[model samples]
Target: MTSDLFDLTGKVAIVTGSSRGIGFAMAQALAEHGAKVVISSRKEDACTEAAKQICDAGGEAIGIPCNIVENDDLDNLVQKTKDAFGKVDILVCNAGISPFFGPATELPDDKFDLIMRANVRANIHLAKLVIPEMKERKDGVIIIISSVAVKKGNNTTAYSISKAAVDQLVRNLAVENSPDNIRVNAIAPGLIKTHFSRVLWENEEALNKRLSKVPMRRIGEPEDIAGVAVMLASKAGNWITGQTFFVDGGDTIDI
Candidate 1:
């Protein structure tokens, strides 16, 4: 028999930015756990391709292209999911951008705005759109994919700040939604080796510098964060909310 704590059968999940990387990994993990998932990204072709892969693996999935920065796109995404799957039991706000790279003082205004809009504002928009249904049913889970940079205070100032905002967003939503039985939390991941962060792990000097700081002595994998997403979406994490769980291979704890 399936354990009640982690059983996700019959659940419907909408995972944004899931065409590739960590977002795709989380969507796949949720599907494997029996949740009918909506795989979404900006590109329609990529979303369809990811959905096909999940279906081939014997998981129920659908593709929905959404650019999170647009309100109409996000609304359409939610509408499409509801229209296709009936209801959404889980919402993974994983679509984020980190275009700016440099010291805080050197950061450009446009890049800063883009990071905030994509990472912080987009997350808030999606959560607002999903929470009404979750509240009415008194059942739902919202998982935000944050970054360990908030804890370690990396030189990626704009990115770190945006993630920190997301962390606080989780806490705020969790506190407000607890009475409705809707849970919200965040996963702060360390240097995961994904296309989004290729600049860090692909560079020899940068990779070595980052590796030396981690107790695990190596970068993380996309699957590393995927497992945590599953746990949070499952009943195993029902009592957990309003917190940021760091999945950084002890990187934050190491001296």
Candidate 2:
């Protein structure tokens, strides 16, 4: 079974916010690698479409829509996955929102609350919901989609702060598990060209400014982060836990 190091055959995965962008790419990759994956997001239609793509590719997948901000939705998501797949082997908490973009000092309380609630608090809740089963099996992988903004700093203070807290969250969970078998980690991507980051990469001037700092001299694509998630979820990354893997194209290192 040495060749099975990266093989995910028969594993069940729940990837939140997987209707598009990084989440979709990771789900697709996991499915392709033989894991049964759930395509989930706020929009049922979008989730269905994403799931269809995976199934069409000869992968096992299902669509389950869930608004990550709602605790009930989170519960339903896990329950739905268990109902369909019998067990959860991997969980990707990739859904998040950043409603405001401005000076940290000027950030309004509502937006700050929204940002933290969506990005940080929600992940904690989802983890709480699924970790018990993982602990019982003594095996699991949780990957959080974080951002390089956590390290480089950004004008959008609330979003940046929330991601920083996520890195710490991964650390805390990984440490508490202490090589017990449930691995919790994160992926910190930089300047990816997706609808979610259009403001930073859409304009010629803005894109060039950000690209100049990246040693790779290019922005990342959703696929760029997908491979890392696959490795982490597979046995190849069993030894690694509670660390933030930077897929930043040298953005964090250049500085």
Candidate 3:
């Protein structure tokens, strides 16, 4: 049963910031493959709507609002998921913030701190919440959504640095948790057409400049990253761990 390799029946997954964009796509795909998914974001209304859409499509899903920057909210998300599904088998730290875009030298201290907290520290906290149970069960998957921004120096210094930090975090966590059969990995996307990336792709000149570097000659859709996430969360990727996959349409090849 080749298809069985990717079947996620009985799996429980929590996807942060899943109200829309890449996170929503991944959550929908995971549920379609038989995983019970939790759709989370800062807004309760948005989360509820997204979750309802999945349910209307015949998938098991629920929405739980969470602000990644808040430790208490992170705790509640994990706890609520357990109350709903008993255990967590997959966690996607897809929520991130890039509120600042400027030269590294000119980045304000407050903005830099906010980026690190939301993109880096918050992920660590969420992972810690699920890991103890994962270690006990001897099976788990953690996928952090990174960005191609880490591959080169860019104006978005704080955001890029935060993603690079998570890249290393994936490797370190993979090594530490491998003994427990837990897999940790990252997916770094490039020039994706999402709300978070509207600033880059919405502008004609900026889009052209970015497309020129992308061998694929087009920007990525949220679904482009969703499939990779499914692979990482299922038995299809059972033997894989500690690697950062570049899903950037060959943009990094030239960089």
Ranking by lDDT: 3, 1, 2
lDDT of 2 at 122: 92
Q: Which residue pairs clash in candidate 3? A: none
User: What is the lDDT of every predicted structure here?
Assistant: 0.92, 0.91, 0.95
Q: Please, what are the lDDT tens digits per residue for candidate 2 over residues 37-70?
A: 9999999999999999999999999999999989
Instruction: Give TM-scores for every candidate, taking all chains together and pairing residue i with residue i.
Output: 0.97, 0.97, 0.98
Clashing pairs in 2: none
- Candidate 2, residue 188: lDDT: 93
Could you tell me how far off, in angstroms, the CA of residue 138 lies in candidate 1 after the best superposition? Answer: 0.7
Least accurate stretch of 10 residues (summed lDDT) in model 3?
1-10
Please list the residue runs of candidate 1 whose C-alpha ends up more than 4 Å from where it truly belongs after superposition: none
lDDT of 1 by residue, 90-199 (tens): 99999888887778999999999989999999889998899999999999999998988897756788889999999999999999997899999999998898899998
Mind sharing the TM-score for model 1?
0.97
Candidate 2 lDDT score at position 20: 90
